[model samples]
Target: MHTLAQLRAGELSGITRLDLAEGLTEFPAQIFDLADTLEVLNLSGNALSSLPDDLHRLTRLRVLFCSDNDFTELPACLGQCQALTMIGFKANRISEVPGAALPPLLRWLILTDNRIENLPTELGERPYLQKLMLAGNRLQSLPPSLSHCHRLELIRIAANRLSELPQWLLTLPSLTWLAYAGNPLETEADAAALEGTAHIDWSALRLEQRLGEGASGVISRATWQRNGQPDTPVAVKLYKGEMTSDGSPLHEMNACITAGLHPNLIRVEGRIGDHPEGQQGLVMQLIDPSYRNLAALPSLASCSRDVYADDCRFSAEVALRIARGIASVAEHLHQQGITHGDLYGHNILLNDQGDCLLGDFGAASFHATTDNLETQALQRIEVRAFGILLGELLERIDSGLSDERRKVLEDLQRRCCQPQVLARPGFSEVVRELRSL
Candidate 1:
């Protein structure tokens, strides 16, 4: 423990270590000068209000332990320390964190008990950040730019005030552990606003590959134990980042599960744990199928004219098959008082048996009442998406369609694409007509 007098007298010239724990209330500038060769500094358990602005001048300093301090703000010049890597500022009053205040080589940043409401987007661009702990903050949301941190592995942000989560957070391939609890957005009432639905049990599951990533959370491959047996493979859906209410993710998961299982619909098995990053994830029967997302698939415009023409040979039988499969799924969902908010080709999966499975329930809703306007509108939107998918698929298979087949499919597409919701035929009607073909 070096005192201010020793620092001022240059008595600590060769001091490579310093411990000012619980004894000092302010950082002495004189100590900063003698720390030119200091590599470790532990000022924890003290009432230090601020750090010396020129503290970064200690070019050889490597570790900083300032946890349990009274720091409301950090010195901006700390970024100049090219060699600094570990920083512990837990239990402080810091509300704002500028991107430039942190060095690029920083690997561990622990800021659990701060008033930080937001993080600079540049923080996510850091290449060396590995573990970020911002659990006890007043943060309302996270920046989508966090996806830039390819090396980030663990992010603990519990007890924050966030409403909705960003989608890109779920798509990060490197993220292995995440925690978001004690938020208002995770409440039951808040989730009820999105859709009037019931809760479903989703605990005791293990997650693997991500199936889809969205603004609210991520859907991944998971496994669940059945009837005291070992794990059963399934797909797990998890809320990605901070949420205002726990009910939002729960509502979506429950809706998907209660909507009942179908050959064309992804089946929900159960949930894993209670927290987002923990075992808490929705377990659904995995669809072992290939996805032909129209949005991502190569279009005829990208290929040579000859190749494009060769692939554009549309077959009526194949067109009818695709149309019928989609209609059948839509019909089932409608009968169960459920409406798929978006039903594009990307959400449709094709199994080995040539069956179509509807997925991506990010926007799905339930309607206990019959023919409600909201449900009807959702159905209309799904029809439009199905119509778009039909057009794209027909444009893919290389075969000319008979005039009769062309007329029928064109009519079906028209009904589904109609801007007037009432003009669109119900999914049942579409399926009946396709079966006739």
Candidate 2:
């Protein structure tokens, strides 16, 4: 959060990164003074709409962020920065994305919450491209050229206007995480799917200590008061009223409600729709305090993979239990027409007894349960995500399994992660196989 005064006074001459956000409407000429050393620049939370013509002069710049601004178009000069790899222009009014606006070495691009209708065909030419955040946009379809991007791993097209998901995405060898909620093409949840979800009133919940916070909502420890009965301790999630990196918070709440009872799922005790503050929320059964996140979120270097702790090790028995729990719950979710788009270890909570619970509907999406090809392909896509998680857990084992058990687990992983999308088995099949082990 640097000030324009400090930049103008030459106080930040040798800095490698700069953050100036005091309502800037135009690029500061003084920024060029440190072009020799600057690598990352953030001008977010400002009023800027465009960049200067000579932005290429910052030869060392590798990352740029201009989110929460008034930009109507992605600046073309940005593509001239030879070293730029990551760019963010979220929460803007951007409707135009020029073909030349893509940087030469791009890896990650964030354009969530914009009005984009189409993408530049040149985006497929960036071989290093991996993560793409395009939620809350007006895209009718994806460019056919995107099929050339074999390295793309994670993508979010939620809240868009696409009538159907491109067939090419199903066959992409590397795609793992995907979210497509809040779109017209989405299948409506069956009326009977949410038959027993209780409508909890806001006044019944007494919020207490904060449990955790994420981009879409805040979770807190609370007490669920019962009429003429004992109060029950619970966990409550109050959704934020804005587009998240994944998609709408209301979509997540809806998915949670549609996802009915599962032993390994975070039990949704009730839904809170009439909050005094007009916020949407959920009342859930409090998970045991001993259970904790299985792994940390991805680091800068491990861009799309979760990072585990140094001491994170599991026995073959414990590993099988975790695998079985996840497979069973995943089978249940898809049966209810819900897909847990983000199935990373970070979204799971576990205890020493190998009891695991899958949480986080922020990236979940609803789809049809009909026995159609499109529905089958969607489930198989998520099978790859599960394969990635199983692979991660297997790699962390300290030693506790027979060679035969190890071979079975490895083979299952290989099948799940195979380049051929249709070769992957469904969650029910995965559950049966794990049960045999």
Backbone clash count, each prediction separately: 24, 0
Q: Point to the candidate with the largest TM-score.
A: 2
- Candidate 1 C-alpha lDDT tens digits along 101-186: 78878776778777889888878777877667776689998877787876665566656787644555544544433444445643
Q: Ten residues in a row with the worst lDDT in model 2? A: 188-197
Deviation from native of the Cα of residue 267 in model 2, angstroms: 0.3
> Which digits, one per residue and each the tens of the lDDT, describe model 2 over residues 1-437?
79999999999989999999999999999999999999999999999998998999999998899999999999999999999999999999999999899987898999999999999999999999899999999999999888988888889999999888899987888888889998888887666656567889998989999999999999999998989999999999999989988999988888888888889998889888578788888899999999999999986558789999998999877887888999899999999888889998999999987899999888888888887887887888899989998898888777788889889999999999888888799988998899998
Clashing pairs in 2: none
The local lDDT score (0 to 100) that residue 30 gets in candidate 2 is 97
lDDT leader: 2
Question: Cα deviation of 391 in candidate 2 (Å)?
Answer: 1.2
Model 2 residue 307 CA deviation (Å) reads 2.1
lDDT of 1 at 360: 60
